[model samples]
Target: SQQGEEDPQALSIQEGENATMNCSYKTSINNLQWYRQNSGRGLVHLILIRSNEREKHSGRLRVTLDTSKKSSSLLITASRAADTASYFCATVTSRLDSGAGSYQLTFGKGTKLSVIP
Candidate 1:
């Protein structure tokens, strides 16, 4: 089953603008993380918010989590054209089989952002 689903799907904006993206998921998660991916490249870790954390910030990025609503949001302040990329949210889910237990990580569809200078 799918876990996280990114909202907006895609976004476009001019340089120096701010961007906001959201993620919604099903099931309990240990933590939620945000990552950025440029075209044809690996994902880069941006920030992580634990289930108990309400909000966090790093540089121009800010993240908020609401376990009650099973939702999270990422906000980018003063976005630049260089910031153009795909953003994804990841969550940890676990499964038990045959009295054994294992954990898995799932990522959202991603929100693609295009920034024009």
Candidate 2:
């Protein structure tokens, strides 16, 4: 299923604004990662684009990928409050009986950002 599912599970802005999130998946993937967790802290690797690559950025974050509209969007520009947390989008295929080519990561149900302050 490509671990797709991220559509405003929760969000509350304040400290500097700018925070968009959206992720959807189903199948077909070689690389597509974006992680950041800062509540209890421990999941940070915000950047990884492959599968032909569409768009990608770092400092301030800015990612975009269409894949024929499979969906993928995450932009956090002037945001602060430590940039809140919870923003995942991992997708790396290969496992249809051990193809040995995947990175093994399927997480969604994120987008819980709350940079109030």
Candidate 3:
């Protein structure tokens, strides 16, 4: 029952098709970030969108945040086999313990995406 839980736990699509993933959180956030991880590799940062922003794009990836619904979605256009990985959404929230500009990050379980060639 934690914040930042992604839906459609797994996804499968053909190469050149699009892939979409969604994440939902429970509390207010300063910003949200997306990351991708290969089977046996570390996570790679994908994109970050501020709470004030509605949508953002980087290359073939498009991210949209809906503060009103406390949810966000990631869309990958023309997904490739190399893009097969687990994608996660993390939320950044302000710390209440007077941590002096420090923040807390909570990540979703992630959606496993498999791109078929």
Candidate 4:
């Protein structure tokens, strides 16, 4: 299994402001992804950055990955109240046991963000 830590357990910001969150992992990973979860729902995949990718962007969201440092950051611009949610970073790791190989997706604790209008 893989493990990760998210900084700043919680955050509060005003609508239209930018929000940033970070994640750090302990093991080698194939890729890193960001997800957003509303109050009572499933997580929605925001973006995926492969180990070889240094940065990626989707709309107003931007993600940066530093494999050497085993860390990643997600930035959201012009955030709105709807953006208020729990953000989590998931890491994909693969391991070989015996003659079989398996992949795992482990998520960090999560960052609870509140957007105030």
lDDT of 1: 0.94
What TM-score should be assigned to candidate 2? Answer: 0.34
Candidate 4: the clashing residue pairs are none
Best by TM-score: 3
CA lDDT of each prediction against the hidden true structure: 0.94, 0.83, 0.95, 0.92
List, residue by residue over 25-81, the lDDT tens digit for candidate 3. 999999999999999899999999999999999999999999999999999999999
Candidate 3 ranges beyond 4 A from true positions:
none
Superior by TM-score: candidate 1 or candidate 2: 1
Model with the higher lDDT, candidate 2 or 4? 4
Residues 48-109 of candidate 2 have per-residue lDDT tens digits of: 88878899898889989888877788889889888878998888777767667535678786
TM-score of each: 0.93, 0.34, 0.96, 0.93
Whole-model lDDT, candidate 3? 0.95
- How does model 4 fare in lDDT? 0.92
Judging by TM-score, tell me the better candidate of 1 and 4. 4
Question: What would the per-residue lDDT of candidate 1 be over residues 12-56, giving only the tens digit for each residue?
Answer: 988889999999999999999999999999999999999999999
TM-score for candidate 4, residues paired by index: 0.93
In model 1, the Cα lDDT at residue 24 comes to 100
Worst 10 residues of 4 by lDDT: 95-104
Error of 2 at 76 (Å): 0.7
